[model samples]
Structures are given as structure tokens and as C-alpha cells.
Target: MKRRATALATLLLTGAGLGMLTVPAEAAPAAPTRTTAVCPTGWGSTQKTGTSAATASLVNIRTGRHDCFDRMVFHVPGVGSSKIGYRVGYVSRLYQDGSGNHIPVAGGAVLEVRVAAPGYDPDTGKATYAGKVNKPLPGVNLTGYRTFKDTRFAGSFEGDTQIGIGVRARLPFRVLQLPDRLVVDVAHTWGTAR
Candidate 1:
């Protein structure tokens, strides 16, 4: 009986040792690797001119956010395939549409956008955009944006319309004229300048 008990103890010790030496069938997965791409620099001085007059009228304005930049879009109807010319740049101040009064904007820098389109309906002689045509226009929300601070309708006169954009700083920007819209994208930084 004593010998049998000693043998049983030896067998239990061997089993425990073998269990410790055994390897797991599967190992935990490695932590995921993260990577981010570098964005381009030197986005500056964008301009485009259309061959024909703009047939559409400016009706609305909107803004959007991107990983590298913030965008503002000028909504126009009936633009279709026609060309629309524009000039956009940083300016000293923004002026009101018809009164020519200096309008105050909230930002470290200002951008002046001039579009070769009308903000009024030619047939009815009414403002195409239902929003306020002056400073403090309604529905231009600039929340949680990195570059844009504020935007205002500067004026619309003689088949041309203007807008003022307030930015965090004098950053790089580009302009795009789409089939029915004009888009302005302001970079978050000037390459390594940020």
C-alpha cells in the first residue's frame, strides 16, 4: 500500500510538469498597426474663367469638413455646362452687398470671393437666395471647423455676386467651379507652416 501511494504521487507530479511544458494551440492576435498619409502643400491662388456666361442664379450656400481642409460651396441653379469665372483671395475686410458698408467678420484672416453670377432672379427681380442678403445672414453655421470662422454674403450686383469668408489664419486655399456649384477649399495649414 505504501509503495502504491508513492507511485500515485509520482504520476500526479509528472502530469503537472507535462501540462506546464505544453504550448497553447493559438496565440492572441497582435495589436493593429495604424498609419496616416501625408497631405500635399502649396495650395494657393486658384482661378477659373468660363467661356460663356453663367445661365444659373446663385440660390444657396453651404460648408463642409475634410481631413485636410474645410470647404464652402456656392449653390447655383441652371449653370449646367456654362462657364463661371471667379476670383478668391485674402482681403483686408468684407463689404456689404449693395450698401458698400464694411462688414465685420470673426476670424484671424479674411477671404474675399467674387463669382461672375447673379444672386437675383432676372425674371422676377427677386433675390434668389432666401437668406438675408446683408451681414449676419441666417443659416451659415461654422461649428467645429478647423479653418473657417465665419461667412457672409458681401453683395450681388450687375450679374456678379460676392462672399466673405473668415478663416483661422492666412492659409492656403483653392477654388473649383463645378457644373452647378463653385467650391472653395481652405487647407488646414500651409505645408509645414502649421
Candidate 2:
């Protein structure tokens, strides 16, 4: 009986050692990448390039103009402390067909406004903005992907991704309240941006 007990204890210890050896090591996550998108800022389907780098984009649902406006007056809902910037131009006038030439907008529309913070890419999904010296994004009211009608589009400023976060409606009207102000619409993309 004594011999059997000693053998059993040795076997148990060996089994425990083998189990630990079989454990797999944790894998490290991939590094984040930078990206951007386009916005008309109260314009009508006018996408301007070379704007500020944004990780996401928002468009009005009712209209396909990539925003809930026809001119630049919409404010960035929660970007009060974000130090937002802008640039004025007419992107709607420059159109293109399959030939890649500057054509005209179908309804003779011209997006006259200042674009601030270019749009975002939706491929990467999200980013980790809370670590080390890089803190998370501020409390901007801009919804993630909920405001737009595109189900395939991921919305809002989620981390450092290129997802759009604004109203995606294509309307022929413009915001009159602040024609020169770009109000960040917290409810721009509805609940989709979150």
C-alpha cells in the first residue's frame, strides 16, 4: 500500500508537468494603421480629397449627400475641444463618368462649403486609443455608424479607424442656422455609428 501511494503521487506530478507544457502562449494583437476618408461639410455629394485625416465618416440617412446638409453650417456635435479645422471649395462642380473627366452634377448642384476632417475608412473596424501616452478620443457627439442608412458601413470615431460618422442622406437643401459653421451632429449617423 505504501508503494502504491508513492507511485500514484509521482504519476500525478508528472501529469501536471505535462499539462503545463501543453499550454499555449498568448498571441499579441496587430499594430494600428492610419487611414482617411472624404466629406462635403454641408455640401451635396461633393467629396473633396486631401482633407484632415479622420478615422470615420458620417452621412445623413434621408439624403445620400454624405451628410444631413446642403451647405456648410452643421456643427461637429462633440468636437468642441478637438481643435477642428476646415477648408473651403466646390467639390460638386467637378464630376466624372467612366471616362474620368470633370463633368457636371446631375441636378446642377454645387456643394459650396468648408470641409473639415476628411472621411474615414471602414475596413479596419476600430482602434485602441487608450494606452500609454495616446489617450482615447474626446467626448464628441458624432455618432459612430448609426446615423446613416448604409448597413454595411461602420460609423463614428471609433478609435483610429477610417469609419464614417455623419448623416448619409443626399438632399438638395442646406442648414440655415450657421451657414458658415460646421456643427458636428451627434445624431448624424443615427445609432449606426456606435
Candidate 3:
């Protein structure tokens, strides 16, 4: 009887009225909060270039928006990994490769993305990436992108394909060469650089 009473007393003492029942700090539920996306460091805004020959044709273009960056990809279907090369740099204006025509793009800054490959099949003499040159890339809707404002196919000539990317501002970016894929990522802001 005494043990039962002592147990009852202990339970009551740890109840709501006594304010003794508690959860460990680490076990407590986290309060809801907003946070910015984290990003890697060390990427810069300087011009980046690599040497490559037209071993394969550029076949497609793709783009995506992430919390920290915006990505653009060039697809060269027949090329091996790291076979694709690029020259990415900020330019005052974007110009066509063959015609030298000035192509106006939206945004505060323009990045000239050059892939060292043709956008046409050499043997068949057929266009691989059928999108019109010097036109805003068809079907690319940058309506809600944090950094990208516009994208255009500058031109493709002499074993090179040029893309013009209009970004909100001059921001850091990085390039990745994968099998048949040349990926470029532009940070949403300076804080998200690299």
C-alpha cells in the first residue's frame, strides 16, 4: 500500500500541475522557420574555357532552376565523357557567330556560352538542334527564375555552337563536363556563388 501511494505521488508530482514533466532540448519540436539555400564556394565570375574539337554534334539544350542556381545544359549525344569543351564568359553584348548580328537579350548581364561542337550532323548535313539561330530559345520560359531572365541561340557555325544567357546580374558560375553533357550553373546571387 505504501509503495503504491509513493508511486502515485511521484506520478502526480511529474504531471502538468507541478510542471515537472518535460522533454529534452534535443527532442523538442523545432519551430517553423524560413532559410535560404546553402551553396558551395570558390566559383568565380571570370571567363572559363577549355579546348575541344567537334567530335560530336550538339543535339539539344536544356535548362533548370534550383534554389541556389540556374542550370543550362548542352547535349552532344555521341561525345564521350569530358570530350565536350566550352568557353563561358560575360560579354557586353551577344553576337551571332556567322553573321555577327547583335542579338539583344533581356537582363542586366549576358553570358556567352560557346560549345566547341557543331549543331549539325557532318555526314548527313542535317541540323541537330533544330531551334532557330539568333532567336529566343523556343519553349524556355524564364518567367519565375531567380537569376535567369532570358536565353537565346546566338548561332552555330564552323564547329561551334553559341548560346546567349541573360542573367539578373553578374554572378559566379561553374561548368561541368559529363558524358555527352556540358552543364553550366549560374548562382542565384553572390552568396550562392559556386
Candidate 4:
């Protein structure tokens, strides 16, 4: 009986040792590295080349929301591949489009967008864009945006048209020139500047 008891104890110890040496069926993968989108670079105050004789007429103005930034597009029609010159920067105050009167916009900072193209048809001497030339242009709506607060038409004069954009703060912005449009995108945060 003592021999039998000793044999059983030896068997139990060997089983326990084997169990510790067994490999797991699978090991959990190392936690995936967190990834983030790479923001665009060089989007601060910028200017592009355009022509003074270009006859691009402003047709529309609109805004869109993005994951990283807010966008504003100024559409000009009937101008081929001509580049529209523009200046985008923060301003102390927003002035009326044509009258140069102080216009109040709701935001922490105001961006002045000036396009080289006019908002009128030179042939007919009539306004090409039918929106309000004053504060609160008819179609631009900024209801649930994070950066944009308000938009106002600053007016068109001497072959240049201006629009006032109210943002949460003075953030990094980029300008893009398409065949028929000019695009402005403002970063939601200064840290996320591309």
C-alpha cells in the first residue's frame, strides 16, 4: 500500500509539471497601434496668382463640413482655366460688401475672403450672383458647424469680391484654385494644422 501511494504522488507531480509546459492555443495580438489621419500642410495665410483681366463671374457660394476642417467654396462660371487670385486672412472687423460699413459677424475671429473675380456681369452691368449683397446672404446656412459661425457678403468692387467668414477662432486655412472655383478650408483646431 505504501508503494502504491508513492506511485500516485509521483504521477500527480508529473502531470502538474506537464500542464505548466503546455502552450496556449492562441495568444492575444498586441494592441493595435493607434492611428490618426495626417492633416494637410502649408494652409496658413496664402495667396495665388490670378489675372486682373479675367472675367470670371461669381455664381455661387457654399459651405461644407469635414472630419478635420470646414470648407467654403466660391463658384465662378464661364472662366476657362484661368486662376482666380485671392487673399484670405483674419481681419479686425467685417465690413459691408460694397458699402464698407461695419458689419457684425458672430464668431471669435473673422476671415476676409477676397476673390479677383467680380460678382457682376460686365456686359449687362447686372449682378451675377443673386444673393444678398449685404449681411446674411440668402443660401449660406451655418446651423451646426464647429468652426463657422456666420457669413456675410462684403461686396464686389473694382474687379474684386469680398466675403466675410466668422469662425470659432483664427485657425490655419488653405486656398485651392480649381478651373471654376476657389476653395477655402479652415482647420477646426490650431494643433491639427496641416
Candidate 5:
């Protein structure tokens, strides 16, 4: 029994001497090897514009969330194969069209979205969106939105419509033109959109 005890002690001392049985005083946290490069960074905050002669009327506005960005969709009813044009850019301040009245948008940065379409029926002259100016968009519940702070109807005048988007900051954004809708996506963060 004494011999076995001695052998065990020798083994332990050897292992310790060889630096193979050492324990750290405090365990260090393992570093994460994962990356968030999946988020896109090409979309800039500069003014993005598309040119088209399509004449549509803005009918609705919608919002959705993604892993990397928050999106806003504008519904414009146009004729067959008609393309919508728009000018999306970050502005120092948003203003109401025709009246030049200052519009208050809640966020670190504001976006002035000018769509080449009116927000009312040209024939009937009836308002289609029906959303009031300087108020949160109707039916758009931004309860848990990460980037979106507020949205308001700037105004529609002279066959042109304007909308204001309030984001967390002046981050990268992209614009998309579809057959009858326009899309705008704002990234949540600079590097990792999560």
C-alpha cells in the first residue's frame, strides 16, 4: 500500500513537472469564432433614385422586420408593366410638400421618400392612404422594431407623394423598385445587424 501511494505521488509530480496537469486559477471564457459578415454593407445612405414615367397612386404602406434590416413597403397601383420611380435619401429635416411646413420625425435620422406618384386618385381626387400627417402610420405597429423609430405621411402634392421614415441612425439603406410597389430597407447596425 505504501509503495502504491508513493507511485501515485511520483506520477502526479511528473505530470505536473511536465506541465500536462496544470489547472488555471480562473477559467477564461472561450472566444467566439463566428462572424456576422452575412449582413450586407454595400447599400449606402446616399440618395438613390430611379426614373420611370409610370403614373400610379400610393394606396398603402407596410413594414416588416428581417434579421439584418427593417423594411418599409409602399403600395402603388399602376397599370400593367408600369414601373415606379422614387428618390430615397437621408435628410436633415423633413418637410410637408406644397406648404413647406416642417414635419417632425422621431429618430436619430430621418429619410425623405419621394415617390413619383400621388397619394390620391387623379380622377376622383379621393385620398387613398388616408393617413394623417405628422402621426405614426396607421395600422403599423412598431412595438418591437429594432431600427424603425417612426413613420409619417409628409404630404402628396402636384402628382408627387412624400413619406418620412425615422430610423435609429443614419445607417445604410437600399431601394428596390417593383411593378407596383417600392421597398426600402434600413440596416439595424453598422457591422452586425443582429
Candidate 6:
């Protein structure tokens, strides 16, 4: 009986040792990684213009942000006692190096904005300005404003300033979208420069 008991204890010890050998040591977790793009604030204003035509000029306006943002908004305050039309066209251009190498940047979706006053029209029945052909308008033109948002501009920014095009047009205008550019034209009005 004692021999049997000793043999059982030896077996138990050997089994315990084998179990210990099969266990794996815990590994320390890897250090956390930092991943983000930092943009700047107050980059001032940058403006560009396209070739002039009979209707209106195409302009590009960009504002600098201290930090990178996913979207951009344009604010057009109402022009009191002014009878004119207001519109905006937006586009994004990729960055280019001085050496002629182009960096592949994501382009923002096209956005077009139009403004008109409610309950006011110089010509109520017709599109032609026959009665007031030489006048601005009969009443105060209640101007309107709007904002559009765009994403996918990440990692393509050189600084806090965003890359985009702004076109403020008069009336009876059209925006032509191309594969890599946009064109806007206006008639019978004037657009204020910002």
C-alpha cells in the first residue's frame, strides 16, 4: 500500500511539471501610436481669378484654419436695398510641386449656390425686363445665403488654408463642370468682391 501511494505522488508531481511547461508567458502590450494631421489657425485669405469673359469672372477664395477640418462653409450676408442676384460655385484643386510634379489630392464634390428674394420680382409675368429695362429692381432684393460640406480632403493639406474655388455670380448664369475644372457665367448684374 505504501509503495502504491509513493508511485501516485510521483505521477502527480510529473503531471504538474508538464502542465507548467505548456503554459505561455504573458507579453506586454505594445506602446500606443499617435496618428493624426495637425492644421493651422488664421492662415489669412488667399484669392485667385480665372480669365474674364462677357458674363462674370471666376474666382477662388480660401481661408486658413488653425486645425485641419473636414468641411468648409461660406457666409453671404444680405445686401440691404440692393436688387441683384447672388450665387456661388465651389471646386477643389490638387497641389503641385514647383518642380512640376503633381501630388494626387482628393477633389471635393461640386457645389452650386443660388439666391432669390421671396414675394418680390421686377417682372412678375415675364423673364424679359421690358418695363424696368434700365432699372435695378422695384423693391429691396432680399439676398440669401447657403453652406455646403465636403470630406475626403485628409492628408492632402499643406497648411491650415483649404484648397477650393469660389464663384459669385450675378443673374441668369450657369456653372459648367468639367473633368478637372469648373466655369461660371453671369449676366444682367454685378457681384461684389470679398
User: Compared with the true structure, what per-residue lDDT tens digits does model 1 show for residues 9-114?
Assistant: 9999999999888877676466797655465686774443444366668888888998788998888868875677777888788886668788787799888888
Residue 91 lDDT in candidate 3: 98
Q: RMSD per prediction, one decimal?
A: 5.4, 19.4, 6.2, 4.5, 4.4, 19.3
TM-scores for the candidates? 0.75, 0.24, 0.80, 0.75, 0.80, 0.19
Worst 10 residues of 3 by lDDT: 13-22
Model 4 C-alpha lDDT versus the unseen true structure: 0.80
What does candidate 4's lDDT look like per residue over 22-129, in tens digits?
877686467787676667655665443445435678988889998778999988886656777787788889776557688787799988888887789867879988
Model 2 lDDT tens row, 1-194:
99999999999999999987774555545579654333334333333333333222222222222432221233333344433344223343432222334432222223323334323324643322211112212332333433332211221232221222223443322232232224322223222221
Q: If ranked by TM-score, best first, what sequence of candidates would result? A: 3, 5, 4, 1, 2, 6
lDDT of 3: 0.85
Candidate 6 at 92: error in angstroms?
26
Query: lDDT of each structure?
Result: 0.78, 0.33, 0.85, 0.80, 0.86, 0.29
Model 3: per-residue Cα lDDT over 1-194, one tens digit each? 99999999988877855564567799899999787667976789999998784378888888898878999888898777656778999999998887889999889999999998888887887988877876888667887888899988976788888989999999999998888889999998787532
Q: Indicate the TM-score of model 3.
A: 0.80
Residues 113-176 of candidate 6: C-alpha lDDT, one tens digit per residue: 3222211223342222111222222221213212112222211111111222222321233433
Alpha carbon lDDT of residue 126, candidate 6?
Answer: 23
Residue 164, candidate 3: alpha-carbon lDDT = 94
lDDT of candidate 2?
A: 0.33
Clashing pairs in 3: none
- Quality of model 5 by C-alpha lDDT: 0.86
Instruction: Candidate 6: list runs displaced more than 4 Å.
Output: 2-7, 22-56, 59-68, 71-194
Model 2: residues with Cα > 4 Å off, grouped in runs: 1-77, 90-92, 95-103, 106-109, 112-114, 121-194
Clashing pairs in 1: 97-154, 97-155
TM-score for candidate 2: 0.24
